[model samples]
Target chain A: MVSRIGKEIELSPVEMASRYSSRALYNLAAGSPDPSTIPVGEIMNSYDRVLSDLGPRALGYPGAGGQESLVKEIENFLPFLGLSIRKGERLVVTSGAQHAIELIAKYLLENEVVVAENPTFVETLTPMKLRSSVVLPVSLDERGMSVDELESLTRTVKVSIVYIIPNCHNPAGVTTCLERRKRLAELAEERNFYILEDDPYRPISTGVPPPVKSFDNNGRVIYVSTFSKILAPGLRIGFILANQEVAEKLALLEQNDFSTSTINQYVVADLLKRGVIQGRTEQLSSHYGRKMKILVESLRENRLDDFNPPSCGFFLLLNLHKDADSVFHTALTKGLLFVPAGPFFLRGGETYARLSVAVAQEEHIVKGVRVLKEVLSQD
Target chain B: MVSRIGKEIELSPVEMASRYSSRALYNLAAGSPDPSTIPVGEIMNSYDRVLSDLGPRALGYPGAGGQESLVKEIENFLPFLGLSIRKGERLVVTSGAQHAIELIAKYLLENEVVVAENPTFVETLTPMKLRSSVVLPVSLDERGMSVDELESLTRTVKVSIVYIIPNCHNPAGVTTCLERRKRLAELAEERNFYILEDDPYRPISTGVPPPVKSFDNNGRVIYVSTFSKILAPGLRIGFILANQEVAEKLALLEQNDFSTSTINQYVVADLLKRGVIQGRTEQLSSHYGRKMKILVESLRENRLDDFNPPSCGFFLLLNLHKDADSVFHTALTKGLLFVPAGPFFLRGGETYARLSVAVAQEEHIVKGVRVLKEVLSQD
Candidate 1:
């Protein structure tokens, strides 16, 4: 029998798509980066270099937090994003950003209120909901999560953490404005809530503003990011930057499963040392940027309901003039697969659907959008 | 401030040792395979082959259960150990056995009684204890966890799961007899409890009996094993073999963090295809077997209290005639680092200590045992 928490977690759309069939013609369901841009050669070279140079040390346990060299490399890499860590602040490498969220939910949000955007990442919301915490879903517009609503909610609720994807909100793809980021940081100080800034897409996307942590003066922002989008998901490398107090606790909690993959840490460290990640990110942004443009232009030509084009990240949220479920099933019949945005929201997301430009090629993007237009026109 | 679960978890001894310094002369404290024995060359070859052959597929998401190719490889490998899976039986690859244990404890043992051996793996106990479940620590004699104690406990306490390391108990270094394994499996059915048999050390160690799962007829046993001990910990590959019902649920639960490493799965699959693991395991058993013999002889010569020399696996249990804490401190001064087995037990473990041959050289094992003898003689 599944435990209460286990029952609360459902198979995400990406998982469902993979299980259904490997023959799906247009895969807009998964928010993964283009597999073609994974830099397989560079990764293979890193593995060879790490194993040969470090010998067996690369295969040993990487300690509780992670490999020290990798952590230090991550520390060195952070300054490039306009974020700085003080002496007392610390970092803990996790399996991925999803794991970072799970650890935070388990360690920091017991019987506390967690505020998030109404239509947020479904996977992200699952961990918070499993905690049985008070999840107050604030609405998000083009400028991102409504701070005015968050402020009002904080007046009555003891908000512990506000989970935000500042750069490119998953499923919604709307970036929070700089002014709102500053206000959110200030609200965290005044209301005494922590900000869990999950920013996996920021590094590999253009027009992403500085992270909320850059505006955080009180160490209330827990900055998290993953190399899955920029480098490769198979590496399972993600890191959390927080104050020493929280970081130490997270490190201890990580002892439950030992460390993340030691070989992965070594490979990531080697890549960072060689400046491979920086170069790859630039190439990825250019590639995905083209895909995003193609999807946006195709959608506009189809005379669909007006929607904001994603400035950065994998997804584009389309506001539908009709029910999303019918459109989703019909598109599937047309050999197209994309996640329905309804599950992403706490309420009233039936009028919205998300298209991911991450997995599909430019040609597939056009074909998938045409299928979507046909499905919507049928309704 | 940390939440309840975070507060309940503490820095394990292995973690403390690693964080204390990277230059520890003797790392007998951690039960990790000797780094030098890691098949780095083979692993490098696998990586090169996987990247060149599978390309981006190696770096893509591995779905919920795992890469089908890797799962099939593990399925084929299990029959070599006298274990068979029915059509309904399933397997889920995890980050490691430790993670598999955590998942089981989280998904299956909530608000239930979890009976484990006294002085069991400290890391294994943490997840069950964190669940706030009633953990009944049964005593273990040379034959293994006293099935009589377990029977008596189950009769009164309604145990949900009996966590046993059937082949080579971690701290005690004793194997459960074949008769006892069969009895334990039968008892699980009679008592309506599940048996979580963690056997990571079984494959690479000689004289270890076939897993208790071989005796399991009614699907009451959930068998979990990791490649960390045999292949390399850095691979973070482990698999759970359970009945179809439980296997399906475990796969769904794994979706909480997407899946394990895709590249790792491909690499492992390639290695299995090439029979690298089979060969490496033979070499490892030979290597560690010699080390185990040396440590046992040195301890016997120094007149340590009578204890079971492990027939298989990594550790030796030394019953001390004096307090183990004092010996532990004194041995540290002499450049030896082994875990005091006191923490492994719930009570009366002050007189026991564990020496691991897993990470130490034969010469260092001798030197460390001599220091242990000197420290114990002082008391």
Candidate 2:
């Protein structure tokens, strides 16, 4: 029988996305990962090597956990993020970070309450809602997730899982401070609830911050990260770090779902072995950093002063003087689109917008902000 | 407040996949689109040249509908499948076929009953389950979904959706005959339910069979296909074909979830344009065909007479002389692992095992079958 949750579940946001045509106009509404920084050429070369390594056998299905070489490389990459995951502790590769999020939500959550950051990545809330979770949004400030708000929410609501983007949040682009992360981890320990620490933007940061998973001495934090942002998003590769019990459950889930794209794992592993990933990250940081400047310059030139400059990731948060809906519609007419922050907000959204710095050219950045300013000022 | 549905959703199989090690023993359980076939090298080259064609300004987030060039290519590809979709009708790149499936489940199904083929792809059921749909498994014979059973169920139950794999059913490797597809399509029209035609393996088949979608003159079939099977699963690229109304609704659903991996879409479009996809498909078909022979040869040598040979796809169903579970355990000891078929069955799963002809060397095939024999002969 179909669960009762599926029957009653309905959200218009996803439906809105389906109607979107990439050819229609500027689509700033989507929080898609940036590809300009993807090390495609190097990854392709690595793919060739991986194919050569596997020979004819590579064309077939891959091993259970993932391609060993890739998993080992993932293990190697974990330490760089300050996570101390043992090889035997469960680490599973997924289609993307979103799939991992869904998996955790399905397993740990039993239609219980989940506490999440308000104004969070709207995509994160969908799976939780589908599962019939009572998702209460924890408030956030400049320092990232409000630990105080999280504590209060947990005290009142029995939360089974807490979803957080510890480093460089999506849409908001706010990084949690180290102290807050420690407090958050400590809270999870005290509450006896699991933490899904999403860190897709870790490598893209201008400077690294210690991950919440790094402070997880009690195995409460299941650290999830993806190479899609660093190497390629299209590859649809991501991993999760968890203890054996949770890992085993997830594996059972994966056994039912399609396993992670195996050949990509092999090629990614090859890239790690060849030290291409390091070079790629460095190159990407420089490339996207330049793109970031263009967007920032345009915002400054246009005197759009209400926005916050992001420390990392591909987006900037714009606090417009006018209502976001009117500005969004006006900007769309002018061929410039940006994601409205209303949907991202857990509590009904106020007047904030998200602008991606990854894809725009230097001139458009200037023009986009000018158009945004024109729309906002008029409204 | 998070939507009630979000909190009640279950963990996904892809998420659960994290339990095992990537580098571990031989694994026959994976539906990941092979990544080596992505033509990443070609895409890298296209990335180099896109600047020249579309110019630097053309590179951004791309139009929300999709890259015009990529959608046009899909236009060309659809005709081969006998679909004549009009331009500007809703079309978008998705994360993968599985994602497209989930999107459809979210939109069209509302507290409804979904009829799926028994022993079908487990991932297919995950989204349905998460959506709280009552999943009624319709049994499958060698000719694909049993028509008599479907007709009987529809008469007795109120079903909203039916997921059918007309060509090359996963795990089972059974293709629905043209007659069965016609009957199924007729039933859908009579019952006023939508048919989700999932055909990830249709192209890989040596002989073409009429697609269930092709028979749908009434637009009841929302056909989903992926580049994952033909290109790379890591690219996580897939598409859905449906009437404008259904497509529009699904587009909205997509807005809430993660958008299709844009970088991967561009890469696929570029590969298709460069004509690299043609060579890869040929190579893939040839490779799998030969591997099937190796698998068949091994079975013949082992004198395993209980299994039926699959006409297409990479799997074969083996009927053990005794309970398949004991054979599964014994095979594990010999390091010749195949997914036990008990999990595939919806009602009873003790009699069968599923083996993939896509991997394993000829020698391993012989040895693995030999191991199966030794284990089975114990009785």
Which one wins on TM-score? 1
Instruction: Report the lDDT tens digits of candidate 1 across residue range B1-379.
Output: 4577877788776566555334557667778888888888899999999899988888876677778899999888887666878766889889888888877777885677788898798887888778846778898888887998898888788788888998767988889888888889999999988999999887787766778898888889999988898888888889899988787877877777653788998888888888888777667888888988898889888887478878778888888867877777777777888887876786678878788888888888888878777777673
User: What TM-score, to 2 decimals, does candidate 1 have?
Assistant: 0.97
lDDT of 1: 0.82
lDDT per model, in order? 0.82, 0.67
Q: Write the per-residue lDDT of candidate 2 for residues A1-379, one digit (tens) a residue.
A: 2234334445444224324424324444444445445555575565567655654344334433456667788888776666767655778876567767776765675567777787777776676665645778887667888998888877777777788887667777678888998998899899988888888888666575788877877778888887766666655577889977676666555533343555556766777777666555656666666766777777787787665566677777778856777776677777777776777787866688877766555566667777777776772
Q: On residues A65-86, what C-alpha lDDT tens digit does candidate 1 reach at each position?
A: 8788999999899977678788
- Tens digits of lDDT, candidate 2, B253-291: 443434354444666787777666645656777666676
- Docking verdict class for candidate 1: medium
Clashes per candidate (backbone, < 3 Å): 1, 63
Candidate 1's C-alpha runs over 4 A off are: B20-23
TM-score of 2: 0.78
